[model samples]
Target: MDNSETHNQRIATMTFTSVYPLYLKKVEKKGRTKEELDQVIAWLTNFDEQKLQELIEENATFEKFFQQASLNPNAHLITGVICGYRVEDIENPLTQQVRYLDKLVDELAKGRKMEKILRGT
Candidate 1:
């Protein structure tokens, strides 16, 4: 199999619950709150607090989590480098979505205002 396919498969199989705590830790260490993280996540994925919790309890895979998401139309407005990858330039849609979340969290951790972090939503 090719490298791209392998990468996608690996990411797709990752559990959202496993990665969520790390995201929480990253933001919390920077003095950001869970509510702010959830707000940004909701803006990006349309998953409210209850729904997010449900997915977490279910241990949804990254692929399943995204598949069930109603991505915001303005998500395209989020553009930046995350983990050395440009969010808008990613060829893999799933990877781009993941990076979009990362970028939002990064902004929040950097103490950006909620309005700006939500991309003026």
Candidate 2:
């Protein structure tokens, strides 16, 4: 297989529970609360606190986590660079979804207000 398939496979196997705390801590360290972080996540994935917690407890992989997600209609509006690639330019849907969350968290940690971070949705 080529590099794109390999990239997608690597991301698909990653556990959502593993990256969650890092997202939380990154926000908290910037004086942003967990609630704020969760809010942005909910906006993107449509996973409420209970569902998010359940996924974590179940040790869901990124693939399963996204498969169950109801992506926000405006999720496409979340455009920017994450992990050196522009989120909007990512050809793989799964990678784009993951980067969408990352970009939102990065915005929150940078002190952008909720409405702005949520892209006014």
Candidate 3:
């Protein structure tokens, strides 16, 4: 398989709980609140606080986390670069979805307004 496919597989295996703290720290350091971070995540994944907590407690991997997600219909509206890749142009659906979240978190830490961050959804 190609290197990208291999890379994607590795990313998919990463646990959400493991990465969630980093996301939280990033936004908080930027003077954003946990509520705001959660809001951004909810906009993308449709996971309520309870469900999100459960996922974290379960140490769910990105693959499993997304499998249980009810992805927002407007997810396709997310665009731009993340980790040197254009998120909207990613061919792998899982990879694209993960990058979508990454892009959103980046925007939040960058102090983007929620309306635009949610892509006016």
Candidate 4:
């Protein structure tokens, strides 16, 4: 299988709760707030704070979390490289969505303004 397919399978089984704290640390170390992270996540996944917490608490896998997500209509606007992969260039739809989330968290950590990170929301 291609790298995207391999990657998809790997990440699909990774728990959201396991990855969430890393995202939080990445942003916080850059002086960004959790609220900013939440806003970007909410923009992409349409999960409110309470719902997001529930998913984390449930130890949802990336696949399960995204399957339940109401992806924002503007998610295509998120285009960038994350962990050396271009988010827009990912072949698998599910992997692309996951990368989109990664890109958003990356931008948040890099101190991007929230409005722009939300694609001008």
On lDDT, the leading prediction is: 3
Model 2, residue 68: distance off in Å is: 0.5
**Tens digit per residue, CA lDDT, model 1, 1-121:** 1238888788889999999999999999999999989999999999989999999999999999999999999999999887777778888888778778889989999999999888787
Off by over 4 Å in 1: 1-3
lDDT tens digits, residues 57-93, model 3? 9999999999999999999999988877788888888
lDDT of 4: 0.89
Residue 50, model 2: Cα distance from true site in angstroms: 0.7
lDDT of 2 by residue, 4-67 (tens): 8888989899999999999999999999999988889899999999999999999999999999
**Alpha-carbon lDDT, every model:** 0.89, 0.90, 0.92, 0.89
**What is the total number of backbone clashes in candidate 2?**
0
* Model 3, runs deviating above 4 Å: 1-3
- Please list all clashing residue pairs in model 4, or write none if there are none: none
Model 3 clash pairs? none
Cα-based lDDT at residue 120, candidate 3: 90
**Candidate 2 regions with alpha-carbon error over 4 angstroms:** 1-3
